[model samples]
Target chain A: MGEIVLSACGLSKKYGLSYALDDVSIEIERGQIFGLVGKNGAGKTTLMRVVCGQSTLFSGSVGLFGHSGKRGLAEARTRVGFMIEAPAFYPKLSARENLKIYCMKRGLPVSENLDGLLASVGLPGVGGKRYSEFSLGMKERLGLALAILGDPELLVLDEPTNGLDPIGISQVRELILRLNRERGVTVLISSHILKELSSVATHFGFIHNGRLIEQLSSKELHARCSDALSLTVDDVEKACAVLENICGCRNYKIFPHNTIRCYDGAVRPELLNRELNENGVGVSSLMREGKDLEAYFIGLLKEGRANAQLY
Target chain B: MLNYIKADLYRIMTRPTFYIWPLLLAALPAAMIAGAGGMYPAGVILAAIPALVYAAFCLMALILTEHTFREDMQLGLYKNDMAGGASRSAVYIAKLITGILLLALLWAVCSLSCIVSASYWLGGDSGLSLLKDMASLQAASLFLRVNVFLAVFQAISIVFKKTSALILVYIAISAAMAYAMKWLGAAWPGLAGFIKHIAGFGAYGNFGAAAGAPHAAGGVALLLAPAACIIVLAAIGSMMFEKKEF
Candidate 1:
């Protein structure tokens, strides 16, 4: 419902004869922690690269902060920050020095909130240690710090927690939450860690084989993923009346072809089936199922594969 | 573009290679002074100074151009720069400007060391005369030649990201071309003469030749010719870089 921060439409990129991204369209709104979920080589990094202007020769239109095209995109990107694939810094320079270079390049004053930024990323007192000497988690932290420089409104992070320890991951998660909640920075983060993403993402975009399969808000995803009992019966009108009156179940949906799904977990299928039979609704089939984020993702991919085979 | 230049300069400053190479070259003049110990006449040292500085210029220019942009590319700093709102052309121009500025800084350091050592060991008056000649239009011609060579090296670095491979290819091509020209000159004089004029090093040779002779007309030609080459190569490099992916 907010202003659209990023809109990419009909993006297609190819290497040799293979398409890296094919007709991929994605949109990110203001103050959203949008999670991009996909497997390796599924065009996650490629899409991020194109959006940030790291890669070229792709056919598409990208609008950021209400601007598009070359000059407009460059102007729009002035307010964006990103770290793609891996964190890059001068190994010989210290953390502060590396950040100093970034700040200078962003045309920000060198003395503005640098120490605070480092501390926020849990890199306090790491002044003298060179980047080469730091651990992988430390490097990731520094990369995050660099991406947040100048208080950029939009942050595009690719596999930010790829090499982090548990503690490092939690710390980064907290920082991301604080940045989004307090500073209102919109985030487009990609990762293979589904549980971690499910914990923080306001919205999720599922990409498979270089195509976006689905985009949904957290509420909608949770609703679709919750446990439910799927039932098929004759006379769906009688089944709805029996479920509400006899089974005391109010949360259910009646579909066409006399199919009904009950979302209420406590509703017993045997009791519902008996009630439907008693109400003169012939019960054809009944099944109960539970689905979480992982199962849902696998189901989507499986369904996509099945459809591909059909064509 | 200014921000990109600043970031590049900062990166260059952090790397020891940038300062170490120039310092090593600057120490050469001091070494010459120490070895001479008045064994050779000051006139011989003064005459050798121009060639020594020219060699140092070429060495520093090559080293800086070979390492600066290629290292940044390998580190993926260009991606960071372009993501931070710098256009591809702007990033390319920034690297070119940084290389030129670094070359100037290194050259100044070496030239200063030579001046100081010559003044201390060879006496003040002769050193002043050497400085005067170095400040002349002939020295400007030499600087222009170095710029052209640096631009060529930069273009090579842009096209070929591998540093060692680039160095080998550059040296091989230059040596092969020089040898081929030499052979042709011996075998067929007229054709060889025409090829030499079109060779990439023609302006460099002219500048070097004019350094000793101090011909005004040749100096002017040397100035314009290398400047033109540098502009064309720089434009081509920029276009290629703009189309480059990552």
Candidate 2:
């Protein structure tokens, strides 16, 4: 909706022949939080690492704030604030002191505005209390506090709600929303929690086998991951032939008892049954399958796995 | 660069290891003095050994570097380190400076111990004049030189991300350099003088010489040589680490 703050073009990273990230491309607009969702080993962390310069690039490039050179990565990174993987902090330092350390290192104008910063993350009265004493959720909140130091323009968090309790997740969610809506900072968050991500993400990017399957707004994902009907028959080959030739319902799958989740919900079940019966192909049952994000993710990954075995 | 340096310092200051090392070094000469009671003159000289021990302590203290970088790298601290106005060069330099400061503090303790103890025992009637002697001055310079050498060695350990290997390398510098120099002397003439000179001894009985008479070697070069070595090693380390991906 606002400026395109992060533009990744042909961004790819490979380990040996297997690509960790394969020619992935995406654009993140300013003032809008972009959620990057993928399964384990799907390259979300790898991509985040490359963008922030903790990891290297095998090919292609990422343009952050319009600066695009190997040497320029350091300069461009100044505008981006992030908490990577599981966040770490000075275990001995108090929350207020940690902020001071962060701010002092950035050479930003030193402020005793520690209270406001801590309060933003709901960590009031955290002064003089060492980080080791904080709970996992409290530590995560403090990590968020450090990330927001000096009011960075774009905040990148990898599983910021990781290991946090329900209440803690809600706190992080609220904080992210406030930072984006109230503070006007763009954010890029990567997580495997589908439903949780689905709630706060204005946009989504589906990464399958280190490749971009789809990069759409939450509205589009919701539309795509919507409910559908699946039919399971006896022989998948026969089911495919019957569905393709007789019913002309081609968009589907032939696995786990010849299942087909029909995207075209308007298909007539009676007609389909009649054709399959007339064709001598046995039909066991028919049921509706909603857009299960987890199932879709597994399907995409399996497809990739199958493709890999071919080579 | 300033920001990163400050941050590195902040990180170091907050580390338990950081405080422990400095405080130990600061309090060591006094502690030994109190502990030895009547051990007298040798107690002070033994204090010098501890000062040198601190230098070794610094060279071997790769865990500080490892812990800082590992926590950051593992927890993704470098990403934010850069985002907080620190470039790669700044990060590298900050660690470098921090390492040197720790080494310097270690050396200062040793030198201060030498000054105090030598003032008590050797400085009698000679007053502080014994400290001004060419031999003591030479020994002080050698100690400073060792500090720089160890600092550079520690810097390498930080960049390479290996602790045991660097520790071995540091021990070699501390224990074997002099022997290696002696061996080199018997083996060759030009190499002999070079080894003896860099080894910080022309005479075994000389100030820096270990409890015996010594030979003759470079004088002005003695002062300039360690400085040159530090600059060159620092450059090599800085260049390697500046653009290195965390």
What's the count of clashing pairs in each model shown?
Answer: 0, 7
Q: Which pairs of residues clash in candidate 2, taking residues 3 or more apart in a chain or in different chains?
A: B202-B215, B203-B214, B204-B212, B204-B213, B204-B214, B205-B212, B205-B213
| Candidate 2, true inter-chain contacts retained | 0.64
TM-score for chain B of all predictions: 0.82, 0.63
Off by over 4 Å in 1: A227-245, A248-290, B14-18, B33-44, B123-125, B179-208, B211-218
Q: Which ten residues in a row have the lowest lDDT in candidate 1 chain A?
A: A287-296
Which tens-of-lDDT digit does each residue in A1-311 have in candidate 1?
89999999999999888888889998899999999988889888999999999888468888899999899999889899898988898888898888888888888998887778888988898966899999988899898888898888999999999889888889889999999999999999988888888888999999888888899998888877867989888788888888888888899988888788898977888888777777788888898866867788899999999999999
lDDT of each: 0.81, 0.68
Q: Relative to the unseen true structure, what is the C-alpha lDDT of residue B244 in candidate 2, on a scale of 0 to 100?
A: 55
Query: Which candidate wins on lDDT?
Result: 1
Best by TM-score: 1
Q: Could you give the interface RMSD of each candidate, to one decimal?
A: 1.3, 2.9
Query: Clash pairs of candidate 1?
Result: none
All candidates' TM-scores? Answer: 0.85, 0.75
Please write out the lDDT profile of model 2 over residues B1-246, one tens digit for every residue.
666666766676666666665566546654554455466565345435434443444443454555444445444456567555455656765665665565555556654654564555444433254344324545544654654554465456645445567667666664676676668767786777655555433422234342122432445565566566666666776676555554
Supply candidate 1's per-residue lDDT for B50.
68
